[model samples]
Target: MAKFSVSLKARLFLHDHGKLLLLKQTKPNGGNYSLIGGTIERKEFAIQTLIRESQEEAGIELSEDDLELVHVLHKRSAKEHRIVLYFRAYHYDGTPESKELEKFENVEWWSLKELPKNLTGTVRHVLKAYNAGLIYSHLRK
Candidate 1:
């Protein structure tokens, strides 16, 4: 029998004043901007997942105490199911940079009111949901 599982991932929503931080990607999942975070490892708590992923992807240190739950998206499609938790942190340590040089060439902060055009649909939805204060939502696509 084939095993089935739902992957849990944590994504960050880091904002500096009115500017939002974004990691520049290439094609397919790149050439667009998305939140900096990754999958929750085995035996790791959700907050811990954010902390570790932030350091890896954005090269910044995040604290569980400093993280606030902004949104949670549970999504399902034909091939995959995932539970993504969005955490917002107003403050963190170190300047943000792309650790994956090949995958991401640059990281920039864009105005929250005027985000870049090449953004993932999911990310765009998340941003709107954040702005509208829609805490929990589900996406099927």
Candidate 2:
């Protein structure tokens, strides 16, 4: 078997007034909460993916300069391996409206201290890294 190359993902770390933005998943990858983002498209930079995904999933606009690369996580599971680029965003345009209704229930804000328990493993690891001020992490399943 050939070893596959690492895939790229873009994730948004959006927080405001002591709360973090999250999406309640629906199926296939449901029952777990996660930040708004997606797989990076071909020929697009991770930053571009961040901007695009934020708009697509959350109905908000983000700029390249408005996002800072805070963490780069190398995560591996039995079936998939990828590099998740986490961008810390301090500003966004308007509130996140409900999009991808079939994939996710709704986008909501949760206090850091009162976050939903069923967060995706990826999200949990990412958040933990953020809280710990880590710039990089390697998680394995």
Candidate 3:
């Protein structure tokens, strides 16, 4: 029997002025714009994972005071059989830049008015939920 494990993931919405920072994934399963996020390590808190992933992937280091807890989502993928804890950050310091990650191809800033059409599924869903005033943990399945 395949056991399902709930995976906690953190995402940062690193917004500056009115634009939001997004990254372009480049890997075996690469795709368009998405937030700066990654999986939480073993025994690591969501907040810690958020900060760590932000710096590792986006090259931006942020403190607890620099981020606001926008949402926590329960995203489950049937294929992977894992739960993802989604988070968003509205405040932070320093500029976001692309690091030397082969998984990421490019980085760009997009405003709320202008979002790429080729965005990933998760990114699309999160944006919709945020706009619908839904910024908290919710079960996907």
lDDT of each: 0.85, 0.87, 0.73
- 1-141 per-residue lDDT for model 1 (tens digits): 555569999988888987888899855445888878888899998899889977887788988888988899988887678999998888999989988776676678989878888888999988888788899888898
**Per-residue lDDT of model 2, residues 1-141, tens digit only:** 956677889898898888989998887656578998889999899999988888888899998889999998998877778999899887899789768877777899999899898988878888898889999999986
Clash pairs for candidate 1: 25-31, 26-30, 26-31
Q: Which residue pairs collide in model 3, if any?
A: 72-137
Estimate candidate 1's alpha-carbon lDDT, on a 0 to 1 scale: 0.85
RMSD of 1: 2.0
Give stretches of model 1 more than 4 Å off. 1-4
Q: Alpha carbon lDDT of residue 111, candidate 2?
A: 95
* Candidate 3 per-residue C-alpha lDDT over 5-102 given as tens digits, one digit per residue, 9 for 90 to 100: 66667777777778878898777546677788778788788778888888787787788777666666676655343445555566666677778467
The lDDT ranking, best first, is 2, 1, 3
